[model samples]
Target: MSYTLDRGDLADLARGAALLGTGGGGDPYIGRLLVDQALRHGPGTITVLDPDDLRDDDFVIPTAQMGAPTVMVEKIPRGDEAVAALRALEDHLGRRADATMPIECGGINSMIPLLVAARTGLPVVDADGMGRAFPELQMETFSVYGVPGSPLAVGGENGETVIIDTGADNRRMEWLARGIAVRLGGVAHIAEYAMSGADVRRTAVPRTLGLGLRIGRALRAARENHRDPVEALADTMAGTLYDKVRVLFRGKVVDVERRTEAGFARGHATIAAFDGPRTLELTFQNEHLVARAGGEVRCVVPDLICVLEADTGEPITTEGLRYGQRAVVVGISTPDLMRSPEALGVFGPRAFGLDMEFQPVEDLVPL
Candidate 1:
């Protein structure tokens, strides 16, 4: 089934995307506003194409904002960066893009592609490279599946653009893009992981946008009815894309340590239990990478570590964490694709420099 995304969906999409962000992917608020404003002035509807309907040879490209999420809040986009990057890559590819997809299905990255689709009249693919957001470009499923990361296009708010052709080394592409983004005022729009429709069907996390929409809708309904939004979220997520969804900790934030380092928001947050000495510690590099309680690892990367407001259940990005904030920490299992050995190698606890081995959230905390 296909449906057009209009302004009505923005709030739910933003809220749901933020939850999927798992404490990173930047704030979706600005992206939602950008999309809302764009729709009012330009296209009234952005078409969403189902991944199963794509033809084998159709050319698909992923678009996203790159660099520090904190930087993006201060340096708002000029509303042309995504399209600029998309067009630049199309020119380099020597063919018209058949569709667009999100590099990740969280926060601003998820909405940017929809905004581009509205402007370019290209259908936005339903799938995304990461089921959740990752701090680095090389961590995408496309990169893990041996997809070429370049010829890549980077566009700046000030009309500066750069195209890179790095063959198949996505790590090199990420390195180059990060340097370029820092020079371009800490944020830039990027297009990468250009692939045929078949490759996308085989590698991309499927139906994530639709999943986000459902999650968002449920959250909204829960809040409107004065229900426990966190429990609503857990019930909504269980046995779906995430095999396990449970509140890992409920407390008040005791400490938050965050800084923009190497063009990424890097930090840790401590949440003290409401009535005990126990505390939950989250280490992050943009997204929460590890969660520990009482000196034991409760959750690790490849699985999701999400921080939410204890009452309203609003997701709190790493950049948004603050001392004394009442919070609930939730752990979610990654999709099957992300639990593979290759996927774990790239996003697991070890990949984040934590000494422990990777364990599924379900294994660590049985549902």
Candidate 2:
């Protein structure tokens, strides 16, 4: 069934998506603002559709943002970049998109599909290529499951556009797209991995937009009810596809070393426990990739590593982490869909150049 999303729902959806982004999808604040702009541009309400309802030949497009997310904090999109990219892709294919969906389920990328859907009057699919956010282009279930990442269309903030039909392996497409994205000003809105409905149903992660919305609702409800918001988050994750949540660490941000390089926010951070000398270290390439506590590997990709405000359980993006802020780091395992050997080879720890085993967050953290 399709449903209308109210203005009231944006906050929760963005909040949930930020948490799930694992620190790398672009800022949720900007994402929400973009959605607000999109709403103002055309439709006041977003219509969401189930993936199962899609017909075999329906044209489905996935929308996203690519480049150093840190750069977006200052260089806000012009609000029409993604829509322009979608139109460019449609023109290249000589077919209009029947529906659109997120390429990722994190931060701005999570909301990009809705923005396109709102402007185009197409229903957004309740699915995404990655169940959560990943920094790089090839690290999606769609790629792992045999989907080409082109003919991809990338659009700049000022209407500059490029139509990419690499149609090669996703890795080659990633480099080609990343290089183009960097040239477009370090942040570009994109439409890629155009798929037929049958292919999307087979390759995309199902119902993740709904999952993110639920996460937002759960956290907001818990906070309003004076319950522990982190606890509420755990309870919500308990019944989801990406179960096995762990309070990885609780501390104050003591250090963050970051730089905008290779069109990505590459960095590391250290959090010191307030009550003890113990510390947790995080290393990320756009998104949190590893969590080490006292020199031990507590969690690694493709599991999610999230830093949330201690009291409110609100997710803090990489740029938002600052000294002395109280924070809690949580880890959530990726679903089996992203854990198979084939999937692991694409996005697992080793894929990130980390020399370690791909252990589920549940095993690494222990119940």
Candidate 3:
């Protein structure tokens, strides 16, 4: 029913979260740091509750950081914001929150629940809304299961907060949340999708926490044994390692174009990756949505378009893309879990406003 937390578990959780993040969710580093720091402080204990364990009267909600993961690096959270989000949401709902659930656990979302659990003395559900990370709050399984995204509360670093309640429709809830996040400087703390335990069981991705713990373990083992972390990761995720594509001209970042629109971190990461006359260009919205080599479309989303350390094969999250960084473009499949029409309808190319159809990652990468 409950278990003690440790570094090993965190590692696995991060890894699993990354896979579940699909091709997005920012980076998992911040989540790792937050959880590690929280555990180090030893406020109390973190417990994982089962979905069926919750009572009809039990109050449950999902908590996560909402904003551009890129801005989070420059604008660090003020530490108490997560708890503040929970408190604000509870105050608005007029109900005591009995447990916290991860909205999605690809990156910081994974750790926010743990932080909330430790700080608020609530147990965390071992599940998440999306089996992997999605670009919008409305895109979660909760939406699929008919849960509303409001009366939600968002907390900021300076003790500022906002509560949103929409009469109907989750998409509007996402829009409001995004607008606030932009005003908050590309990052905001949020508590959303308040639901009953039975609802959570029906909507949340089951055993994701345990799955995250496993991913962390696989990465740790790969690092300790000097194995290729990517391969180790592939095996763990049961994902196919797509064949390499031509180097989309590897160089330093020259320009980055971004704008906060419709509650999504929409942007492009441009780099000069050629030594001579050959250069490349990449375009993305939430994740690396598309790539171009010599003006040719080389990679696309609905598949995993990832930037990794050339030497280490570590993934670079959407927010982590920066200038003057030399990284390799790696493409992997989205795993069958996310390849369904329901999943694609939300995160597929059309959802991001791209004119192109959703192509499997394998179709674009060269053999």
Candidate 1 local lDDT, residue 98: 94
- Please report, in order, the local distance difference test score of every candidate based on alpha carbons: 0.89, 0.88, 0.71
How well does each candidate superpose onto the true structure, as a TM-score?
0.98, 0.98, 0.80
Candidate 2 deviation (Cα RMSD): 1.1
| Every candidate's CA RMSD | 1.0, 1.1, 4.2
**Clashes within 3 Å, all models in order:** 0, 0, 13
lDDT of 3 by residue, 1-367 (tens): 5565665467667665664454367567677777778777865458888777788767898889887765776777777787898889888778888899899857778888887877677889887876656677787777766788888898988899899888557889888888888888878889999999888877776767776776667766777788866666666655322223233335666667776564466777776664666555666666567777777666665565656555554556666667777766655665454556776676677777777777665566544
Task: Sort by TM-score, best first.
Answer: 1, 2, 3
Instruction: Give the clashing pairs for model 2.
Output: none
How much is the lDDT of residue 352 in candidate 3?
A: 70
Please write out the lDDT profile of model 2 over residues 1-367, one tens digit for every residue. Answer: 6677856788999999998899989997788887887787667999898888899999998888898988889888888889999999999989999999899999898888888877789889998988888888899999999889888899998788898776757888888889988898799989998999999889988888888999999888887888888789888888678878898999999999999998999889999998999999999988999999989999899889999988778889887888988999999987889889999999998888999988888888887
